[model samples]
Target: MMLKRVAVIGAGAAGLCAAKHVLSRLNRFAPPVRVGTYANGRPIHSSMYRDLRTNLPKEVMMFPDFPFDSRLNSFLPHHEVQRYLESYCQSHAIRPHIRFNTAVDSVRPVEGEEKTTTWQMTSSDSSGRQKTETFDAVFAKCHSSLSLSPSLSLSLSIGEVLHSHSYRYAEPYAGQTVVVLGAKASGLDISIELVKVGAKVTLSHRLPRITYPLPAGIQQSSPVVAVEDDGRLRFQDGSVSAADLGLEIQDHVMTPLYHFLTPPAFPSLFFIGICKMVCPFPNFNVQVQFCLAVLDGSVALPSRGQMEEEVRRELQEKLARGVEHRHLHMMQLEQWDYCDALARLGGFTPLPPVIRSLYEEVWRQRGVHPQKYRDLNYQLVSDARWEALN
Candidate 1:
């Protein structure tokens, strides 16, 4: 059996690659399949901030077959990434297949007498016209939401409260006493950006104190525990403060997924770009390949029950090892093994030594000087070495 039609939700890096790869392998299908991409906006609703530069260099951030322009900086600003995605769509003829400004409302599986299932997708366009379409398969690359602590609730009378999702520019927060929760990438980057713009920034996280140098006016503190009745903030370490502005920088966790890709109960649907703390773009490349393999029967997955059990065991191990429930999908140092497993199962080349070396070097630089890391430039000299340019 061959897939006759596929729907790719979101036109971001992952969705674009999914569509491109599907189109590339049209000859493999008995009959060529039609692919459609849906996006709620202009296809650039990435969680990118105005001044944000990529943590990983462009060398490793690119798909294996496509390279970013060598003339561009190693660490590119957010807008450059958006432009690259736009260019990717145009170059691969993906834009014509996309329904921009259309939001997918629901996706439900229609069971059939045979084992195969079809998906009914309900979506609305910018004009509020609703439409329903059926597809042979679906790739959901939709954005997830940031999880905030349950105890902290803010009233309208409280000062500005913003999730990192709504964060765009630091100019709007120039003179406020900002308390940023979560010391992860966005939290740290936004705090530094705010401090540069004269905001008195207090970074609060449950993790151990960060060793990287932070600019003056940016201080670290314990995580916020609660919001008092009098509008005061309570901290984990029994500290209290009056916060004028709050920024939640915690990473967004994708809803529980099987193997971080498939929903256990629904094998026809797949998710990409859900794993965190890894080289994102390259990881997405391999994930999309694996999904295609599953669809084309090139890779055989276990029975539904077995796959669900495997996902449960993986999550249990992470939880037993003290990993947060929400962070079950985080690969971190385990990304290499995870990527290799995907490539092995999906019949793709593993990441090269150059990508690994560059990835590690950037990580080390980030640890040593989080604020100054992006200021340095790097070039991959070979498969095993990267040189930092002065």
Candidate 2:
């Protein structure tokens, strides 16, 4: 049997893991090909910021098969993580298979004999050279965009409105009063950075009032709902903030996925790392292994109708548990069980129990000391155990 021709798009964390696993199983797979749009002078989609350090410790964030350098800090800067990914790529000899500076334009499924899918993908390099390729299996990223109300969309007319996605460094806005929106990870990190740079920050959010001791220069306020007629900011509680400029943090895409792994109708196409509130690297590890099993016929998939029914039933169960529709994909506590189920179904070794235990400990610490949890460190030892250090 000829090895399957597989195409993996987006050479990020998940893509790299998929490629690594594909290369290891030579009998059932060809050399995997990857296409990514993230290079210098190319379209930027990465969330890395210049001065950002990971909120989670490296012990909890690293891939199970590959560990970070033993000498580096537990909470590493963005560049360190990038370097680690580069090292992983080199260690696995995955660089030669990637198409650098290439962007995927479209992926259309061509049905073949017996209802099998052959993916026809079109891509263009930075130099505008286009190429079309057909592959036996395709792994890609899912794209979604959030819909802003007209009033909020018009708020962009205000003098300076910068989304955190575009924010790389905090120096340019020093000494300026900035209104940061959203109180989640990026929002909180950005707020703290601005305050350290002599910038006055008004943190606006929809969540309950933060009880933690925030930095002195930061002030908390209600979520920003709209812009005033004069271009000032209006909050959800009818309050307004007057500031020199503004900074907002928001996700570009929001859509409901039928299943976290792959669509029932498109078993040959897998979307990885789309779930929110996940331990990313380990999550990618489990997902790619499961997808590989699906591709090589080790794990038999259900019929299309049955898959669709399972999806509906899963969503209904989540709703019955009082989970909001918007949070259907937020699998914070559910990820462990999900990983276990996938491992059992695919006949792969499950993630070590130490990872989940350490992750849960970090979550508890984050609740008690949101801003200081990073000061803690951990060392993973043999026998699925981790030791906490000061």
Candidate 3:
């Protein structure tokens, strides 16, 4: 059978998972589809930051069939995650299908019609030769929410501003004062990591409370009340010492770079993840489910009614019934809404579902049940103000 050709750009977690899911469906039903992956560098998983570790536990971060080894310990470091990605490619036997060193420069539809897409992919081989290729369907698996710290305006700055991305080993800033900004996982992690290396660290949280790791091994703080000059970080109803300035924290997610790739076409692209943005897990889960549905023709697009209907059915049956399955639901929904808005604005109707059973499976796995907080003054989880319910 001649398969429908699908090309996935970016060889990261989202891209890899999309390919794996597509391949599984194709193999099972013999769908007329072919899958290919394109990446700028070799198909290795290296994070932009050096001190990076998967925020989620290894169990949650890894694929279902390919779990990380138990002997490797809990939190997987950046280098180890990269190695695991290589292993995932090898185990899935998709290495041959990936064209590494092929960086995508631009992505636009083919000519006038919107059904087809052509990516202006540029890549340099190991021999340092550049080449380009155009593919049918493109999935941008590239990392979206970049962590580069914004340049603090000179007027507002009391000290040096740095992003969690530039942070590596703490040795460079030893014996200096630092104020960490943002209050997300990266900022919190940096604050602790720096403190160990002898730099006096003060976390400058913009929010009312800093999200700390549960069970309180470390990195957990009381509450940040205010920021004091003379380089002191004060907690709500408590106080800490001041220090000499090495680094000052700034909110990167608040910048335009945080919304970099939110284009108004094939809207599924936006829900994957925002660099430092946090969303309720179930919302994200809905978005992922929607992506699978949209790509596989299990859920139709353009009709906001259809997407919302299917989502409602699934949430009531699968997601809301159990706590374990609920985390990814919101995540999935976020992606769906983002993509749907973009598609409507771009005048493209989403592909309707051809496989009825996949829709059933989405409902079954996610289960049918109403949201636990459905009565909290919100119309539906699909509403734009759904985040307020959280």
TM-score list, all predictions: 0.92, 0.92, 0.57
The parts of candidate 3 lying over 4 Å away from their true place are 25-55, 111-130, 142-145, 155-160, 209-264, 267-271, 275-292, 303-390
Best by lDDT: 2
Residue-level lDDT of model 3, residues 1-390, one tens digit each, is: 444455566556655555665566664222212224334354333335566555443433445346666556444577887788778767766676666655544555554375544444454555557766554445553333343435433223345545554555667777777656555546655666676677766655545553323212223344445556544556655866453443434432211111223233433343344322322122222233445455556544444454455544644564465633313222332444554454444344422221122222322322232111112211112212112222
TM-score of 2: 0.92
Which pairs of residues collide in candidate 2? 144-253
Cα misplacement distance, residue 74 of candidate 2 (Å): 1.0
**Cα displacement (Å) at residue 65, model 3:** 2.8
C-alpha RMSD (angstroms) for model 2? 2.6
Give the worst 10-residue stretch by lDDT in candidate 3: 370-379
Residues 1-390 of candidate 1 have per-residue lDDT tens digits of 454577888757888888888888776532212234445353334456678788888887988778788888889987888888888878887776777767777889998767779899898877779999888788877443334443367654558888777788899889888889888888888998999889999899988898867889998999888888877778888988777888876655654476689876777789887888888888888888888888888898888888888888888888899998767777888888888899999898887778877888888989998877888877777767778776
Q: Relative to the unseen true structure, what is the C-alpha lDDT of residue 205 in candidate 2, on a scale of 0 to 100? A: 79
Best by TM-score: 1
lDDT score for residue 166 of model 1 = 73
Greater TM-score among 1 and 2 belongs to 1
Q: After superposition, how far is residue 134 of candidate 1 from its true place, in Å?
A: 0.8
Q: Least lDDT summed over 10 consecutive residues: which range in candidate 1?
A: 29-38
Candidate 2 residue spans exceeding 4 A from truth: 37-42, 142-151, 154-157, 251-258
